[model samples]
Target: MGSLHPAEKPKAIDLSHHLNNLSRSRHPSPLKDILKYMVQPGMISLAGGLPHPSLFPFESLHTRAYAPDSNLAPGETKHGVVDIHIPQTSASTSNIAIALQYGPGTGCSPNLVSFLREFTARVMQPAYADYEILIHSGNTDGWNKIVNLLCEFGDYILVEAHTYPSAQALWAPMGCKGAPIAMDGDGLLVEDLRRVLANWETDHPGVRRPKLLYVVPVGQNPTGSTMTFERKQAVYALCVEYDIIICEDDPYYFLQLPAYAPPASRKQESQQDEQALLASLVPSFLNLDYQGRVIRLETFSKTLGPGNRLGYFVCNPIFAERLLRATEVTTQTPSGWSQAILAELLSAWGQSGYLTWLRNLRDSYAIRRDWMCDLLAERFDLENSPVPTEGVLAFAKGHGSRADRKQLFSFVQPKAGMFLWLKLNLIGNPEYERLRAAAGPNVEAQWNEAFWMQMIEAKVLLTPGSYYTPWEGRDPSPNRRKEEGVTYFRLTFAFESHEEMRLGIDRMARTFELSWNLVA
Candidate 1:
């Protein structure tokens, strides 16, 4: 796919006619509006029940040295170490005085808000003229607020075939239904999306037309499929045509990996080459949004740490204000301490230093990804092997040798993110095929349960694909039936150490060989 040039003009969208009823009803908080002017010079009036900063007892905070480089030698003491310190004073942005005291529900600290604004302008560069940002607890919290603000009960939410489990959990309890769109090696297919929308009324009689699309565009959860710039453009065009609001939940946007190459094919590159690769990532939906239809949910969970519980929403002013009102009633604001600490770090790092940090993170994850993929390849004995037996390849006109047909498993080498989605050869398993025939309507669920148990016994744990699958009642596409009984697993290469990753894969390989009766 070709890259989107910054100078190219994006097609404009009319957002005023696209807002949901709840969004249209929401208005800015009166208290929050007045709090902004309360912080003027030499103005010390008692306002919205804010506590005295002096009563707080915290004197100072200190953290251990942080080294960006992970390749330090065992005895390396003076190579690079920077200790972080925050004093409890009224002057500093990291001061405990403001952190402990009550603050705006929209954002805790002014300095942190300013830093994020600059970061978003430089990185995302949303094309909309009247965009706004609001800090919240995290992506999960942000998603909940979005769902409440945009969707009514029993509304339809369009989602990828396999998506984040937590999103499904949030939608189910609220009486919202998921209409699954088919996906491929490159994430959500634009063709499938068009078909679903075109035949919505016929396929789903009496159901409300879906107005919301929830997608993890970059390094999509579980699937590990990154949508190309062209694919995003096509999907955005559909959204405009259908007047759907896009909730872009992209936590792994910055964790994108470089183009895949065999281990031996990789050669050392210069710093300039590495920098160029980072700058050449696919543009986000927000960048393409000419109208205010896309609400981007960005989190510190993936980049900084989940413990911080901080994230922000970037949307058109209309939706942003409504989301802020929703936030006022729910989480109110993200942790003040987290906001202060992040502001301090970003102020010190600046724009260039922050980009450098992201590059370091990407490189580290890439190392882990390479290690896991290489190990899986060795375990599967896929060295110079043809494509394995699967849906698309099974009935191909020109088939390869019998040896290729004997291969029992395969996976798409993830271009980005921490997951490796392994597609199991359940069709080749005698027990699976036998049970599938006579297990009645609940066959798919039963088979998935049995397969999960076997993997657990083999001492290799993984998230079953069923968790990511959309609800059956809401999915009317014929493609959903074909995937109902399919066996797949999601493995994360983020938390495990190198030794642990290898050992887990080794156990999983043994189980695969025994189950499929494959020769070593």
Candidate 2:
């Protein structure tokens, strides 16, 4: 060795761009906070919003090729690996080990993508399997990447009138604006969106048009309304006209009401009663996209486990490439372990069988929905609340819309997504009805404070309604929306068990009843 040359140590790298303490990912796990305060040993928790682990395919995965060759039989651990056994073929073990390694920027696992592509094609579009796909940490991760790739501060983005809260928050801080498109039973109103965009363009010609449109197509969050095929087409047509991109956020696509009967009846099977078949569905935006403008996000949180935080997005290469670059720069890659585990579960389910499994999940949720609705009926006299329309949400515009907005601060109908989006009466509402119903005008704010305070005093936690609105004016506070007149509160039913769900409803019912007495 000339000059006793040795391997040089790596020089210290300068911390320039990485020095900031900002986070792309959402911290202060909201779900964790709810669980910590609300969970009691014997408390029947309708508060639970996560999937039931009992339903996961742990055994199915272990029995099939999901595992390595080693642990096929009991009490056998090949190579001292705790979980995997290698009796059938050690070569399989090597493949599994490779999956464990850090994958590409998009993802290491293509198995899940392959299955998902096939699934989307057979069910959504026949030609979609040709489109590009990318794995993400979850829907939020995919959303963040898309925002980074396309949006700049004060950029206009179209969202639903009632949409996911986290998405609303993420967009606002980035200096982007969220414009809401009205939604009805069908889904996002294309005609309304067309009018809004046209008006905005005319009013603010100097500003750029909305860069992207965000939506939750299947079992929509907060609203629980799924888009029909015709509506989806109309929306897509509008997007094409406006030349805007579509971000399809569909975490609950597979979590339909458990009442859908397979298409066997189309081939002339025995006629089943309507009561016998109650599965619900409609096509997804990604499935309907012919122009490759849709980036569809799929998540396992609703159907599988939320903690897994595993999801994938499929879009055209133009956006996909940018998104993957963002992923590389941000998260680098989704959890390799989660990708492999899900791939195994998906493989075991097989293609057709997976649909059947999803059907069963629908049934379970349908039962829960029915149970919850019955509870509400018995308690609140929902005739007063908004009627249950779609999947998980119930929207009843009490006294608010017609008269005083404050009077509108009535109870919300049990809607979809394990949440009840409550509409409260605030001073902003010109239609404040609390005055006529009771003493004077001050009753509106008093009632609002009283309701939330009681819920907190009762040890129940819920997300406030204002959290969902985009770029609305607000006062200074830790939760800025509180100071604003966003009188919306979301209560979930997904995580809580049946008994706990009942109890939660009972508690809510009691709270409402007490408030009602005060107003009377």
Model 2's number of clashes is 38
| TM-score attained by model 2 | 0.69
Tens digits of per-residue lDDT, candidate 2, 1-520, equal: 1111113212112212211123333234344445445435666767755455344333222323222222212123433222322122133322344344434566756677888877765555522334567888888887877777667677778888777878878878866766778766546788878877888756556877785888987666675566777888888888877777788887776665533222343232232233232223565675456566677877787766788888887776655655665565567667766776677666655775566555555545655665666665555423343543322332122433333322323333322344445555444433334543566644545555666778777766666554555564342112222333435667665667768877877676556545544233
Pairs that collide, model 1:
none
lDDT for every model?
0.75, 0.58
User: What TM-score, computed on C-alpha atoms, does each candidate reach?
Assistant: 0.89, 0.69
Q: For residues 1-520, what per-residue lDDT tens digits would candidate 1 score against the true structure?
A: 1134435535334565555677777676777766778888887777677777778878877764344443322223533555667778857557887777667777768888788887776777777656678998999999988887778878889999898888978878778778889887788999999998999998888988999999999888888888998999999999989989999999999888876566899765444343474467778898778777899999989888999999999887767767777776667777888887887777766776667667667767877887888777565555332532121221111122454444454567777888878666566566667777776776657777876788799888999887898864644455454754357789998888788989998887776666655534
Give per-residue lDDT, candidate 2, residue 140: 85
Once model 2 is optimally superposed onto the true structure by TM-score, how far is the C-alpha of residue 126 displaced, in angstroms? 5.9
Candidate 2 ranges with C-alpha deviation above 4 Å:
1-96, 126-129, 258-280, 384-416, 424-449, 472-486, 518-520
